[model samples]
Every structure is written in structure tokens, then in C-alpha cells.
Target: MSNNFKGGRGRRKERGPRTNDQIRIPECRLMSDEEQYGVVSIDKAREIAEELGVDLIEIAPTAKPPVVKLMDYGKFKYEQQKKAAEAKKKQAKVQLKEIQLRPNIEAHDLETKLKKAYKFLENGDKVKFVMQFRGREMAYKDMGKEKFESILAGVCEEASAAIESPIKMMGNRIITIVAPVKKK
Candidate 1:
């Protein structure tokens, strides 16, 4: 028998600033919110941070002399998380909405599906049109393609939609993806 499981230690951990007692460099370039302290011994920097009731955080450990800063580590982390949250809130998530149809769909049903696809595009959701062929219906691939193209053209003309993926066959189904055009 062979064991294929790997230990969790093989995974890489996120790197963060070394704060307070975790900073072990003997000397480093120190900076504070008010001014820069040039190059100074770690003990001197720690003394200044301790006098100001702030933590000594190593910001650039890869620098020639290492760069440390005197700041409230908790406050710094909070501000970083707040910025990240703000960015995430401003980002838009595009969802994919799939609409299934058949090659022999009636004109009225096709119109309804097109209307639904337009609504999806207006709401900033991508649309995927899929038509599956059954048995003998697969022989008329050109008809399926024509139907898919006609529906897509109608939807694109009605709404400001652009094709993200062209019509392609997946197994027994023909599918295409469309997305809303970005406003300048």
C-alpha cells in the first residue's frame, strides 16, 4: 500500500509584518507617522516605540538594513482590512444566466426568450444560449446553427450586447455567451 497524503506544512503561509517582540533585527531604518529616524539600532527603536506606547513593526525585512516603523499594529491592520472591504464593495460580480431553447422553437417562444435575455443583459448579467439536439435532430446541425445565430442577432440588435463566446458545439448542444456592452 502507498500513502499519497501530504502534510499541511507543504502549503505556503501568508507573510505579514513582524510586530513588537517579533522584530529581531539588531539594526534597521526606522520611520514614524511624523518623521523618519534614519538608521538606528533595534534596541533604540524599540525604546522610542515603547516610550510612545506604539509597537515596532518591521515593514521591509528585505531591505539592506531592514526597515521598521513605529505604529499601532492593530490600527494599521484595521485600516488595511477597511480598504480591502471598500474595494470589494465597489467591485461588480457578473453572473451567467443560461437560457435553453430548441431548434424548432415557435416564433413567439423565441421572442419571449429573447426578451428575457435582453433583461439579463440590461441587469449586467452574461447570457448563455444553449440548444440541445435529440437523436435524429442532430443530423440538421446547420439548422441549429442558423436558429442560434438568428436569435443572437435579434437579441444583439435589440440590446447593447456583445458576443463573449461564439456559437460552438458541446456534445449534442450548441451554445454561445453574450455580455452587455460597457458604457463609456
Candidate 2:
């Protein structure tokens, strides 16, 4: 086999913002932490960057004359990644949790299901209740609907949940969604 395979997964190039010699513009609006150099030739900018021991980074390539900044490119990249990670950590991820039910479920069993659903809602997750019907159980869809409605009411009242989707019948199942009410 050859060392290079056609269309194989190869080492990908870094596609980040242009820096140093990658900037092809003739002139740019230069800026730095200590002062703004206004407009200057690319060569002058590269010289200043070299004197300051930092990379000449093109921040706004679309701006008039294109804006460039003198800074440590590696440090800037690290800080950007750090901010992104912090944002992801603070973001709330809402997951959809499904709870299955049967028309003939006993009272205690239904209560157990509601407890689990409540736990999920309390943890910033959406709950989808599915009332499944099998064989002759389809005939008792009305009974299933009533039971589902009662379950929804109890959940909303006791768990501070709001009905996200009204109850609907889908083929062999009755479905509804509930989400925890946001606290002010």
C-alpha cells in the first residue's frame, strides 16, 4: 500500500484567523494594547510586531483597510478557547426524557412514573409521556386519555411543571410534553 491514500483522513490544517505573513493586504489599520497605530504599511506593521515580539493578526479583514492587531497569537487562541469552554459550561442543556405508560397501569405504578418525571423536570429536562396501547387496548383510548390528563394535572400542580404540548393521539399512543416552570 502507498503512504498517501486517496481521500484519506489526513492531518487537517488550522483554519484560524490570518496572522503574520499570512496577511496579504498592502496596508492595514494597526492597533496594539498600548496604543493605536492608525493606518500603516504591512511592512511597517510586521516590523513593529517583530520589535514587540508578537504576531501581526488580521482581526477584521472586511473592514476598510482591514484592521490588524499586534498580539501573542498563541495566547489569544488559548484565551478564545478558554472563553468558549466557560460558555459551554454555563449553558443549560435541556434533554428530552420519555416515560412510557399503559392504560391499565395501577395507581401506585403511575405515581412512581410521575415521581421519575418530576425528577427529570426539576433537573432542567423536558418530559414526554407516552401512553402506549397494544392489541385490544386500543379500544380504551378514551380511558388512557383521561388517565394521562389526570397525570398531567397532578404533575403541573405538585411539580411546578407547565404543559409544553397539549395531549394528542398518535397511532397507538397518547402523547404530551411537560417542562419545568422557570423560576424568577
Candidate 3:
């Protein structure tokens, strides 16, 4: 299916630049408050900001009209920080970890490797268990593949394959990825 398909239809038509939420002000904004330099003069604006005890934030520029607002700059900054912190807390951090093994791995070796992977998963990290083959080990590719699957099962409830197993032809490294279980 096409990636841009919308409800089985083609991509939607292009739209013009979206309107901004900021309220626009006339270029000669300062003149209304008490004429001076085009829009409200800088001096008068400063006076207004001081009177209202809020900042005269410039909201828009470059357009035929420019805009400014009277608001608490500190409060605005504080709210923005709050929103950012909330977004950060809502995000989930995923990390990748690696475990190496030799083709002639013994039962204890496998168990140790499995323990390391379990620790990684419990800590929210994915494990990429690599089975490196030496000279004769390459001839028995099935052994490595079988061992990889066995390791996957060993971490059963804690992890799952992130991608299809990848076998590298470089010298003799067989790599596979096992992703951590998503936290509930």
C-alpha cells in the first residue's frame, strides 16, 4: 500500500500556509496609544509594560502587520518549561545492549549469557546477542542459529526478536537482535 494513502484514497491536496494563533497588530500600533515612531514608540511601550507589570512580547514580525502582547514573560517561560517536563516524563527510553558468545559455549556459558540479557531487559534495555564463529564453527551455521533461538527462548517472557535474524559474512560474526519487553 502507498504510504500516503488516506482511507484508500490518494494523498490529500496541498494546503496554503496555516494561519497562526497569535493575534496580529497593525504596523503603526504605537500611534494609537499615543503616536510617535510608527507603531507604539519603544519608550511608550516600555512605559506600558511597566504600568501593566508585564512584558510587551513581540508576537509577530515581517508581515505587513506586526503584533505585540502584554503578558507575564516569567509566567510564560515557566509554563513552557512545565510542558517540556511533562513531555519528557511521558516518553519511554529504549536502550540497546550486547552480549557476546563463542560457538563452543557450554551450558553454564549460556546460562550466564541469559542472565545478563535478563538483567538488561529488566532495566529497559534491548540485548543483541552475538554468536561469533571461528574456523570450523562457520561450517556448522545451523548450530549457531539453533543456539540463537534457544537463547531467545531462555529470555522468553523478558524479550523478543526486534528484527529478522541478521547473519553477517564478515570474517565470521553471526548477529541477531533481541528487544526488551515493553513495560506495562
Clashes of each: 0, 0, 2
C-alpha RMSD for every candidate: 4.0, 2.9, 12.9
Give the range of the ten consecutive residues with the poorest summed lDDT in model 3.
Answer: 15-24
Model 2: per-residue lDDT, tens digit, 90-164? 999999999999999998998899889989999989999999999999988898889889888989999999999
Question: How big is the positional error of residue 180 in model 3, measured in Å on the Cα after superposition?
Answer: 2.1
Which clashing pairs does model 2 show? Answer: none
* Alpha-carbon shift of residue 97 in model 3 (angstroms): 0.5
Off by over 4 Å in 1: 1-15
> What's the C-alpha lDDT at position 172 in model 1?
93
- Descending-TM-score candidate ranking: 2, 1, 3
lDDT of 1 by residue, 50-127 (tens): 899999888889998999988998998998899999999999999999999998889899888888988999999999
Best by lDDT: 2
Report the lDDT tens digits of candidate 3 across residue range 31-99.
223333356654566676677666655544454445455566676568768999999999978777889
Q: How are the candidates ranked when ordered by lDDT, highest leading?
A: 2, 1, 3
How much lDDT does each candidate structure score? Answer: 0.89, 0.92, 0.63
Q: Which model is ahead, 1 or 2, in terms of TM-score?
A: 2
